[model samples]
Target: MGKFGIAFTIAILMVACKEDPSAKEESKQGFRMTDEERNATPQVQKQPEKNFRTFTNLADTTFIRLADFSDGFAYDLRYATENNFLKEKVYDCAECYTRVKTAKALLMANKEFEKYGVRIKFFDCYRPNSVQYKMWAIVPNPQYVANPKKGSIHNKGGAVDITLETLDGKELDMGTDFDFFGKRAYHDMTELPRKILENRKLLKETMEKHGFWSTRTEWWHYNLSGAHKDKVANFKWECE
Candidate 1:
């Protein structure tokens, strides 16, 4: 081998070592990347997993957060803020929880409501028994607040205060806001606009069909069937 042969071999090696962006791009389409090409590429950061929790091994009466099981429902949670009739915040944070059975019923009810292009928007769910005492301290009247000593179905984790809202999140007019104490909020009230009456009827019938019963005076309130049998719970949720 002469200097010409060695120089020609060196020239061939130099040509092979040169990078070609167009060739790399073409190979990327076929995913036939060399180790060097792969090392040079930026890695795609993986997205965070969604926090869609589950109810496996949970008891039907066990209280659990509704948002963990599904993201279908909306929440207003007025008591967590000063937006309620009590004119004060009662909860440390806004969260909705209910017994597994009640949560199952609500999931079904919301699915049915989706056919009507709406879903359940919760005002409250599974009030801590201590919160009941707080509410009673504020109202101190059986006409408005349930007796904390007896405890309402909410304390038992089988009651939810909810209203229907469009999928876009607009609330249906039920003639009155949540916590209204007058006859206007009554399920039996007939003086409301026809649209309001129809909205209440839809909410009531759907809930009742899914193992819930409504209160005569509070259209937003619904108690799961046999929920009165559960002991009132005083456990409070941790807030972040």
Candidate 2:
């Protein structure tokens, strides 16, 4: 072929080889990764199950004072601590609507407890993602705060940190304070007083009955059934 014709053919080939941005994006959208690529890709590590606890509303439990139970707990209590901020606002983790439903379910399940003058005293709930990051930064331990990218079960709107309180508002002795990170929180069946042990057992049994389970470390920590256990979500509870 003549030089001009050859050059023209080469230019056409070059243009054909060049990728169109939109077409390239469409190709990416349609492309399927091979198993090797999928496995080799760095995955976002899931938040480890640090504290293993569950919750339940006792049967026949009653609330005598009818105080706003929601007020006692942090709005973000379910996911991260109050220290986590989003959009320049500190969310109340406990005040999350999803947690309120769970709490209400517990109250409903334990009508007798209400009559007997006992109610749930929440410590924390619905943690913000940013706050979880901060907790991890401080501790760098999954036992305490979840990795920000992975997130905690609380972020899923299903876990709660709580304890039982009497009708007159006295906290039950559950071995250690909520979020206590040592051996004290472990449910050592033989170590605590009989009454305190009984209280712990009672709490465990009641929560288990209503689809919650306690962590091995903290008595007050309980997770709702299969909610936050397996998934990493970006749900943030907003409180005005």
TM-score of each model, in listed order: 0.80, 0.57
lDDT of 1 by residue, 96-142 (tens): 98999999899999999999999999999999989999999999999
Q: Candidate 2 residues 22-106, lDDT tens each?
A: 7777698897567798689687989974452233453221211112442332222423343322212244333543454455655
In terms of TM-score, how similar is model 2 to the real structure? Answer: 0.57
**Number of residue pairs clashing in candidate 1, backbone atoms closer than 3 angstroms, sequence gap of 3 or more or interchain:** 0
Model 2 residue runs over 4 Å out of place are 1-104, 110-112, 229-240
The most accurate candidate by TM-score is 1
Give the distance in Å from residue 73's predicted Cα in candidate 1 to where it truly belongs.
0.4
lDDT of 2: 0.61
Error of 1 at 173 (Å): 0.9
What's the CA error at residue 240 for candidate 2, in Å? 5.2
